[model samples]
Target chain A: MKLIIFPPIPSILVSLFVFLALRHFLELRERAPRLNWLLKYLWVLALPLLLVVRITGSRWDTGVFWQIDAVYVVLMVALAGVVLIRLRALQPARTLLVALAPFALYALAKVPDVFLDNLMVFSFGNPADIYWLFSIAWLVGGTLVAYKQQTLLQQQRLEHELEARIKARNQELEQLVEERTASLVRQAGELRETLEELRVTQNQLVQSEKMASLGELTAGIAHEIQNPLNFVTNFADVSTELLGELREEQQRGQEADPELEAELLTDLEQNLTKITHHGHRAASIVRGMLEHSRASTGERLPTDLNQLADEYLRLAYHGLRAKNKSFNATLDTDLAPDLPLVEAVGPDVGRVLLNLFTNAFYAVQQRREQQPGPDYTPTVRVRTRLLPGGSVQISVRDNGTGIPEAVRQKIFQPFFTTKPTGQGTGLGLSLSYDIITKGHNGTLSFVTEEGQGTEFIIELPLSARNSPAPTPGGPAVNPAPQTERSSG
Target chain B: MNILVVDDELDVRALFEQRFRREIRGGQLRFAFAHSGEEALDYLHEHASEVVLILSDINMPGMSGLELLGHIRQEYAAPPPPAPPQVMMLTAYGDDDSRRQALELGASDFLTKPVDFVALKQKLLQLAAHDDAPPL
Candidate 1:
């Protein structure tokens, strides 16, 4: 039987086209086993085989066919070896291609004698059909295996993509959680700061309240003792005078009984000295108490209003803080630098400022509790400025619960208080009023708004009937005569 | 010279009598006790001619020494005697308010008590000497 070979030009052109196709699909992307090995690779083998046989002319007698077959076998074996070494990835389809390439080359060299005779004569007959069945079964089985492997690779790729997406999602969730936690931490920090402020305020308030109650107790004790003290001092002097008379009688020799008079005089002298000593002691003690009970208005001197206001503002803020543990407020002060020192009782002015500041803080703190929010900031501000008139205006202002209209008129009356029992003496504003207006000849007034806050304004004259410069180690003496007013 | 001692305390009268016993015996100084300002005024009216000095406490039960000082200034100090009975006010408080008020009310002098009896005696002697000399 004769073998049919395709012409060289057309076969070569077809082979070149198939080679470019293989380069485009098989060379670019390593597809699944079905396409890479079972289908596309067959084109690689079949086309190469066709070229080898066509170049060799399918005539082994020329000896050129044998030479070309040998060369082709060498090239195929070398290509297979290089591919096998480079493809260490261990894919079943690629591994099979490398393994079969040399065998395919050798079979193409002998296809005319060995494969063509059976295909031409014994092809399509009943006997050949049996052979085709075996080949079909093998092809079907290989196709099945290739398809299964391809399906598995696709499944693996989908699983890999799902895993990546899940990892990305997890990282995003973790970042969100971290941000939330940080915000919570920051909020907690603010709360801690607020709590710390409250604690400081409470400590200061309690301390001031204790001092105030103690002062009240001291004043009460001093008042109670003053009357008895007067008697002791008076009687002691009277008794001493009696002793003097006895001495005078002895000097004049007027006693009817000398020995009896001498005994009585000696006893009276001893008792009088003791009484005088104790009487002076009591008197001095009472004097000290009187000094502490209130400002000795007679001792008014030039005082720095700004410095005084600032000091008492801090003191009052701290004082309020001590009383109320959960109360806190921002304190701000602006005292004029150019304020000339005004004539005032320093302690009295201090007390006035303290009263005003305490009231301001209380108002703000009440407002804060009533309207609870981050926006609500409790605050007390103290400002001092030299007014156009011959006076310094000191104002203690607060953004707080201001005086209600109904009770405004009663604020300055003695025994009137808005604070709960034991919290206030009810005499603070009245006494403060007296101190400012009467003690220092200052105007004590207020500017307030209901449900907002209050600002107490105190205006003191710069020149308050100039007092005498203090004499060294002596009590304050009015160098000049002054008119008297009702010292409230 | 008759001196009126006006105070609320009962012990003050005995104390004054004991102290001025020598003076009283010598007839140089005479002390009369009056417990209240009103009583002192009553005594003053009765012995206005004899009394040479009035030492009165400012604070008292019925009438304050200040009120009594006003009475004495109006009734006694006006028709000045040859030796006008010097009115000295005694007080427990040393503050200028009371002192000023006492002096304003025609008190001859102001003294804070637990009185210095030595000073009081000296003041008394000075007042007597001044009265003898002439009215200022």
Candidate 2:
């Protein structure tokens, strides 16, 4: 068998470099598994063929030796081309070019030997030196490729770690926001509960104050009605006796005197008149009391302000008198003669007037006790006037110690009072103010001179009868123009 | 027997006068009227010795019947004019507080209006009998 001459070391070294670079490049790539596997195993076949060509030196046929050499070179070059194309996207251009260096050197070394016939043109340089240089070049190229692959692997690992840390931090931040939102919702629920509790407590206080005022009026009402009732029964009894006497005289037949009969008849007639008058008085008082106490219908009615003020003034005066018999106050009422009927809730307005009158009486009574003499005459005056604007104003004044400068600002506030704790409910002025302002769309204000007297004025619109009734705790139909005016 | 009727109502005077008209005409009983406690006091000062009984209403403008009873009790504590004036309290309210207070103040009796004149006459007759006066 004939062998062909071939430089075996360069061929082997080039094969080794391509093999190492191809293996790493395939490892880096993760797609086209069947193709990558076939390309990588082809090196096993090419390495053996290369060693066989080098051992059989020119003893083989020339065509067969060259064909073996050409086949292995073609296989290795095909492997490098495939690897370069696959790793093009994954690796830098410089690293890919270095990977191809040994293949190019192999091709250069063989080309000269193949074209020139028996031309040992470079016989001056030993073939061993050329093999060593090519081997060293291949070793350096393989090392560089290996180093680049290691760097790319470490970079990929670091990127994966950074992505994992970011995901974990995002989850933690979501949990923190969720916890804060839940806490805020819980606090809002607690605040709503507290507000409801306070509203209930305020409602209870308002109810209790109403009951207290009713209690204060009961004694006076009883006394006022009882006086007329006494007269009613007594006159009836006396009339019965007179009738009996007159009948006895008439039954005496011819002895009965006409003058005595006529006198008895006259007495009977007088007694009946007295009885009727007292009965009417008692009934009127009861009717007034019932009207004041009935539940509010929340409807506007045409009401005579003069009569309402007069009735409440008398009621309040009698109530104070019933409590202490020695307590005296002169009541002066100046009612407008042609005052237009006011559009108001009758019972609600009555209550406000009663409260104001009661407070006035109390103030005067207090001042009377403090500075008593014939000189200081306690008096409460009520004056009703028709303003030019379609409204009416009622003023309640007292000759008594007025409100202090410091406490006047809080006079209409609920649960604020100058009276001894048990004596006053403190809700009187506040409720009265609300009734006049919110219930009737009227203004309730006061003017006071410290130590002299205080006058509370209530101005109610007369033409608001057709307007919608004010709903409880809702905005008034027309806000009072003077609502913001502070009273002193 | 001279009796003083004290009340705040003006109509009480006419009612009492008519009720005891026969007795007044027959001279068996005499009725004097005063409008209030202060007027009653003035009347008592003038006719303290002649007054045999005082009927005063408990609820009045100036002074109450209980207070008047207290005043009378102090004034006629150890008196000797036929007899110390007996005070009867009259009130519209038939409450325990007023009754108890009237009694505590040495009131001779407590009456609620409209007073039963029949019962009142019987009581007055009983007192008149004790005083050796003729009953109407």
Candidate 3:
């Protein structure tokens, strides 16, 4: 048989193409999952078949070809079948094992041919074909291994970068949440302050309404009392003249001197005295009621605070007694001797004192009610003292059942009253507070214990009487009195 | 002399009438009563030239006595017509504001309620004396 020759250059080219095809199949499988099975099958079987066809071209009739060619065909066919099975199962290890088996067999089959040829040629076999086959197999196997190593390295690098980006995003989200939470907390604090301010404003408004109603009621009562007082004064005047006439008749002895003249004179004197006394008392009562009912009237003036307190205290006590005849409480005043004259509206200041006196009276009465005995006489002490820095401190103290702690804090609040509904407008203390504090540029505060008693303290700056006119939206300052002292 | 007493309370008007009974019957003064500011104004309108004096309460529902006085002042701004009544304000509230307002509104004088008859008589006698005097 003619010597068969296989072109070495074409075989090398086929092996090179097989390597490229395997690379393309791997890229397709990674990038596109839908085409992965098809690409893997082509990589495992088709490329190898093409390699064989190229290596065996025009060399089929050689005697040695029949022997090695059949073995090559069987091994190639077995590789194809294993690769096809692996593709169906999609197993990476199985595919690699099947691919490596045929490559190993092909390399080993060329060993015998190399040994025999070397022995015949130069007392040593020519091993060129075996060497070529073994080198080709090694190239294919090494290329596959290198490709796998490169893919694993690339996957590890991508995972590390992705993990870093995720951590950064989570940190940014946490910071945003913190900032939003802080803003919400700030807004809540502002809302709470606003609510407290609104509550104070509402209290002021209710107190003003109560003052208006009380003014109306006092005015009405004063009108009703005026006529009786006038009658008392008139009758007393008439009786005095009649008594004078009777004494003149007795001196002349014009009538029967049955001692009727003396008796008539004495009776007239007593009746006239009683009538005059009661008439003046009623007149004072009306005046006090009138002052209490009146609203702020004129500009502020420099006032003798001690005298003002005394007059209002008298009126307040009488007014309380008039309402409840059994309500008898002694009031003691401890006015400062050298208290500097403070400028304030006399009528308005009088009203504030009246409120305090009335409240003290009520507190003492309440205490008396709780303790049942003849000796349970209630007493209210009103004292004024000159403080350093031209300030005056006035306090009203009562030995009454003190306010409970739970309600003590709320006493100055408008509409918060311990008295029964009809008896109190509930604005008295709040109005008094406003008058002393905001209206007079002073301070009003109180202290109380459960069983001991209660005391309301007011401090006024002497300069407050001459305070400048209040601007709109600013707190109201009391108007100063306009007149100088005339007579007591 | 005809006197008009204006107040909202019926009892207050009755008390005034009772107190002035002697003067009213003797024809030294004739009594007329109006229960509200509006009623007083209407009476004044009809008897403008006849009323000798007016005693009015300052606080009344609807139109106050002060408002009535204001109307009277406006109507009699010039030399008052014949027998134009002298107006006096009577109020339970003796505040300076009311007093100033009353005086400003041309009220001749003011007296607080629970009135003293002696003081009232003295004021009436003084007003009568002033009325007897010729206008300067």
Candidate 4:
């Protein structure tokens, strides 16, 4: 190695830089990768170029150049063939043939060089030395390429294993999703079953409520009739006694003064008058109660809208006031004077108006609570007007908390109310709806704005059929709950 | 003997006044009226010694007839030298519950409305007669 002189250090550095730079360039464009033939063949050029630089510009002998040249040729041919074979671009035979081309050309040129060397004088080392150097270079470059290819195959296997794991995980995830979907479907079925059970229970509860209302009505009747009965029996007994006294006085007329006779007779007459008056009063009360209890006569009677409205408005207001001392609001009534009879069920129309007025009052009261001040001044206005189509329009408007948009659709639904627990039955509007539409052949509707106010409108045609209001044991028989709660 | 008629009904006052008119004018009986249990209790508080009997209706608006009975039994327990004032209860309901409660609260008699005025008059007359009898 010393005889071969110092191995050109700058050449080694420059050649390595060029080879690594080209390999990195190919790697960067790995997506569209081509064979890195330039990377392999670069060493072949570098060895020769170094030799030429030593030969032409330095004091190296011609024999040394020839030996180096032969070693470079054989090493280049062998490494090039290995690179071609590793690339998988050619069969072994073709790669061997292509790799031998440069050596073949060198051999042909050597023939002429040997003849020239015979004529002109130059010294070279033994042929074995060139073969020895060529063997060393070929061994090193071929092993490096083999090692690099082995590493690439190992990395490829690792990537294949990773891909298989990912595929398996994805399949498991899909199975889990399918199972979750099945479980969700099963739960939905169970929920539907529970819903059906709830509906049945709700129906039973409604039946119980009807029975309870009947009980309350009976108790109320018993209490109400007691007062009139007291008067009736007392007055009747008093009259009988008075008549007996008058009879005795008449028997004593022989001894009695005319004045005493007249006074006794007058007292008996007055007792009779009181008995008649109280008897009639008791009879009328019974009549009113009977009318209230019986289902409608199913006949259309001329209904008075204003009188009904006025009576119930005062009743509902006073009723609420009686129950709740804190409740107060301004009530305004606008009745069209001389309004014609609607020819509808009187109680049914009365019920619709009362429900509207109650809801209006409730709204204003709730609003007043949320924003309390002297200036708040909650007001409810009830208006009745006859439309051109022979329909009566009764509207109850209140300046109170309005119907919420989210709950508006459900307002008329049975058992739907925004009132706090126990304050409402949530059936008022629903029953009113049934009475106006199904019971009286009328329409019930409302308009509302959040936090501002609400207005309920009831429209009844003048010549509606005489359908009994639902209250005298219609669907309310099973209405199960809200009727006992309703004051109207 | 003084009698207290307690009821919220105005008609009750007129009816009682007329029914006992002969006795009242003859000085055989005196009648005092109170509109509610509270009024009855107030009148009795002032004139408890003079009143010989109290006939109270059960369901007055203020203090109930049963409540008045409790108050009278507790606060105005008449001494036994003379008979404790007899208390009769009247109720529109005439329920077993009201009857039991009134009796338990020391009501001497329980009557349901419309009460038999004849029976009531006879009972008062007997009480007057008992008062007239010689002391043991």
Considering every candidate listed, which one attains the maximal lDDT?
2
Q: Candidate 3: list runs displaced more than 4 Å.
A: A1-37, A43-204, A207-209, A212-304, A343-352, A371-373, A404-410, A413-415, A421-441, A447-452, A464-488, B1-136
Task: Quote the chain B TM-score of every prediction.
Answer: 0.86, 0.91, 0.86, 0.91
| lDDT score at residue A332, model 3, on the 0-100 scale | 73
Arrange candidates, best TM-score first: 2, 3, 4, 1
The alpha-carbon deviation from the true structure for residue A20 of candidate 3, after best TM-score superposition, in angstroms, is 14
Top candidate when judged by DockQ against the true structure: 2
- Tens digit of per-residue lDDT, candidate 1, span B1-136: 6788998666566456655555666766778889888798889778767788889977553366877787777774454454456788886555677788877877778997767776877777676666556555
Model 4 chain A poorest 10 in a row by lDDT:
A479-488
TM-score of each: 0.33, 0.56, 0.43, 0.42
Better of 1 and 4 by DockQ: 4
lDDT of 1 by residue, A1-488 (tens): 32223222333344446335433423424533433343335455656665766775775433344444434444544444444444435353454454344444443544444323332333455443444445445545644564565467667878999999999999999999999999999999999998899768744653454357335335334433454465466556555665665576678765455764775576566556545654665564455334434434557678888766764554455445434433556667788999887877776677667678778877888897899865776878889898887778998888888877777777877558989998796667876776666566666777777776777788787776642232354312112211212111
Tens digits of per-residue lDDT for model 4 on A382-477? 888988877888878888888766776677777887878866666667756766776676677777777778777778887754432434435531
Shift of residue A428 alpha carbon in model 4, Å: 5.3
Residue-pair clash count for candidate 1: 11
Instruction: Give the alpha-carbon lDDT of every model.
Output: 0.62, 0.75, 0.63, 0.65
Candidate 2, what DockQ?
0.27
Which candidate wins on TM-score?
A: 2
Winner of 2 and 3 under lDDT: 2
Q: After superposition, how far is residue A107 of candidate 2 from its true place, in Å?
A: 14
| Cα RMSD (angstroms) for every candidate in the order listed | 20.1, 10.2, 20.0, 15.5
